[model samples]
Target: MLKLDAYPQGFEEDDRLRSAFTRNLTLHFSDRPAPPSVDGAIRSAGVPKTLIRYWHDPHDVPDDVRACLASWDRLHNEGFEFRTFNDASATAYIAERYGAQQLKAFARCRHPAMRSDYLRLCFVLAEGGFYVDADDVLLGDGWRTIFLNGTLKLQPLCYDIFSSGMVPAAEIWRHDLPTEGRIFYVNNDPIAAPAGHPVLRRALGRATEKLLGNDPRPEIQATTGPGNLTAALVAHARDLAFAGAPFDFELLHDWDAIAETRWDLTYRGDARNWRNMDALGI
Candidate 1:
């Protein structure tokens, strides 16, 4: 049921294409079991016991990445199912699961990182589970608590524009963090949610339209990464508040301790990393 309409005749008709895309998503999700709700509040439970990760090339994983991948693999004994997809396989999977339009949108992604971002949304939206970046390593059994609830769990992040650095995780909780020099966004990694999450739906739709039809090649962050997710979350919260409904989600704390991204890997300096692609004009 995935779809977007052709509108080459005029760019002003982009809004119509977006509407078509959302309508298609509605048709697809309408058939799925809605997330558990009680008394106008979404209760997180019933999330599937699946763990998904992605890398561009599954055939040639690096040594450092193997260590990080092993951390998640060790959880297999703890009743979690670990699954992986590569660039080619990810395209095939989306094509089979969501049909032609979704596959076309996935093809629009220019890098493996963006593909990973979009695939997580597609997988979790359709199949309710957990998706973590391959670079992140699990520290301990604390991951159990994250899977215990079906609510979407995202790591919160704040960047200080003035200092050109990230604010410490502990201080990101402060109410005054939204000042002029601060930018608040949620990390897209470690996404845990039940199927049919409204926030996920919004993010997916926005990301899709941007990839397939937005003016100017959309920037990587705002188009598919954390910026898209944060925008969707804030918008969903406003909608819920306006309707007097409860907003349901959890911003994970101490995630730096539970699981952290290993920054010293070989790919960090090469074009394999998206930041390098941006800077080196790859």
Candidate 2:
């Protein structure tokens, strides 16, 4: 079941986001069938085909964003799960004050982003096991793009200059932050690591210690927390490269550039090997 939480009401803001998510979900999940796999036999198969369908309408997205969203959505539904853990206690307060449904009951709130819960929401989802963005639409037929390929994939943050397209744990620890400041790397958008990988464990450990609890140090609060942590992962990957490890540094760097170039919807042009992948029916 889709579990939503409660938040303070700003009628205009809540209404707008609710409409957007409804429209986006409708578009994203509409007419989609389960893949021919074990998951098809699971509960996911029973989700309403028309739960969201607007995404099928290409007219709503510009040409550039179409491919990215399509690919993202496909991955999200096929392999990844999505969720959030938010201020249940605070929500309980709202319910009691306003004579609404009980705290334990689920109610749709505005998209967590509008409620200042975007980062934590994504992090909790990641911790709970999901790897895609809230609005990323998936393209293509399978999720192999994120897995079979040696290079990890993520939407790079243009907000930082030293970011990678995909930050693995190897690269994160190497980020050169100022002496007095802390660095964080964010892979909150869509990050691919082997499920149950050690790097993910370490990243989660750091996130749990830093983000979830009361261990908020001054440096941690001042720096870009999650994004910086993701950057640290990329830096860690660089260390592996230095150690003569078997990794495609060149490919990783290329992906970093691609993410920076807004590769989500904007194709990386006709010259790259993605063109080759396309030509091969990939």
Candidate 3:
């Protein structure tokens, strides 16, 4: 029952978080359709039985990532077809599928992480399926439950500035959580959606416009990372609420219990990790 009257100091002192959390709360309580757990997922939905992943370079994958990727095979056994893309292959796919505009935007991405962020949106929008980060590993076999519908499944995230860590998932929905030090949003990874989902279209279009802008190097997170996705989700939720329609997306909970990113991957210590890029102000 933690609540606050104002945005506490050291919480970035911004109003966006408060408004963002208010919008997110609506989706959480709405009577939007969700998967049924007892009978398992219905595979007849248009979302393909495919799992997509990407890396900038194919030949130079680190051992840690290889091990993590090996774990994804368990999902393949569950009938999920897997595909891995490198920079070259990803470029080719975008050019062939989305035409010149998206290809130019892909070229605009300055880093691997940015490229990955942008590409996932395109792949998911053009062809319905699941997209995961390369370093993520599958921990459970009950993933079929997520395929029950065409709704975009994204993991909701909340950060506590006061504690300098994430707020637990179970507690983020409480009406009394301290608002001043908390920021609620969503992650882009592990995206699950049917083809032509409006949220993915919005995020991809946003990233494309930012990358094509005058900035030689766009801000990674705000341009194509979690921030971009969060903004799109907020906008979509607002639109749906205003239209008196149910939400088109679902908030994924306990995803870490099924799959998680291997934080110890060697590349995380170097320039490859987007957090490092943010630190160097690149």
Candidate 4:
């Protein structure tokens, strides 16, 4: 079992129990092959599979963000492709393809951060490629290699405990937890998927529903952020499992060696960052 100083109120104890349940259920099915949809996606991969970035405008992009883009561009030239979609291009693309409803949701988003979440999901589902937030920098050739080899995999959908800090501890404890804290929440900053992957499609739908709803809360994480993405992933895993395939989702924990080298530039002073650091006992 994992140990922590305090679970910020009510996170870890329930997570501990859920983790136990999932393990017991799946212990005998560990070595099964991935589902057919996953296998088919791997085989039908297309390229130059894009590396997508969304920003307000090319001129407005920060220097740090530009540097990160450059890093990917350099690796991209070796054997991949990259594209940037500013507001205008992104807006038009959504309007043309996904229709006025999605386009309106994209525009109606009060926060720029929320707009970005919708844009990334739409672009990836439509064009089928990798998406990386401008704020994150690639560590090395691992990402490129994974794409080139068509071995890119989805991290298991898990809630980010750090994002749950604002929730009353009692509420968190009472909520049905998914997995034990053993899995890391898949960070949305870097993602790769073939065009029309079911996971991305489902996420796009969920995000659109939340955005178009009457909810007044402005929290992007719950509406269209990593938490939203993680939920879609969990659904996708369940679908696969129901079809008698193993839960073959590749998790970030499995890629620690490569992930350790990558960095989230925005994490430095955020309270959530400190919480995560504490959770990891770093």
- Prediction RMSDs, each to the true structure: 9.6, 18.2, 4.8, 9.7
Cα lDDT of model 1 by residue, 204-272, tens digit: 988888888855455788788987887676566545545667547777765787798999998887888
lDDT score for candidate 1 against the true structure? 0.73
Stretches off by above 4 angstroms in model 3 are 1-23, 26-35, 38-44, 278-282
Cα error, candidate 2, residue 43 (Å): 23
The segments of candidate 4 whose C-alpha lies over 4 angstroms from its true place after superposition are 1-48, 148-152, 155-184, 246-249, 253-282
Model 1 residue 119 lDDT score: 93
Question: How badly does each model clash, as a count of residue pairs?
Answer: 1, 50, 0, 1
Using lDDT as the yardstick, the better of models 1 and 3 is: 3
**What does candidate 3 score on TM?**
0.87
Ranked by lDDT from best down, the candidates are 3, 1, 4, 2
The top-ranked prediction according to TM-score is 3
lDDT of each: 0.73, 0.33, 0.77, 0.56
- Expressed as tens digits, the lDDT of each residue in 1-282 for candidate 3 is 112223243222234753454435534653345456634445646678888999999989999899988888866556678878889999989988997888999998888999999889988899989998998888865576678767888887778888999987667656566667667778898899989999889889888888889998688878898878877776676566556788777777657776888787789888888888867665
In model 4, how large is the Cα lDDT of residue 27?
34
Where does candidate 3 clash, by residue pair? none
lDDT of 3: 0.77
Ranking 1 against 2 by lDDT, winner: 1
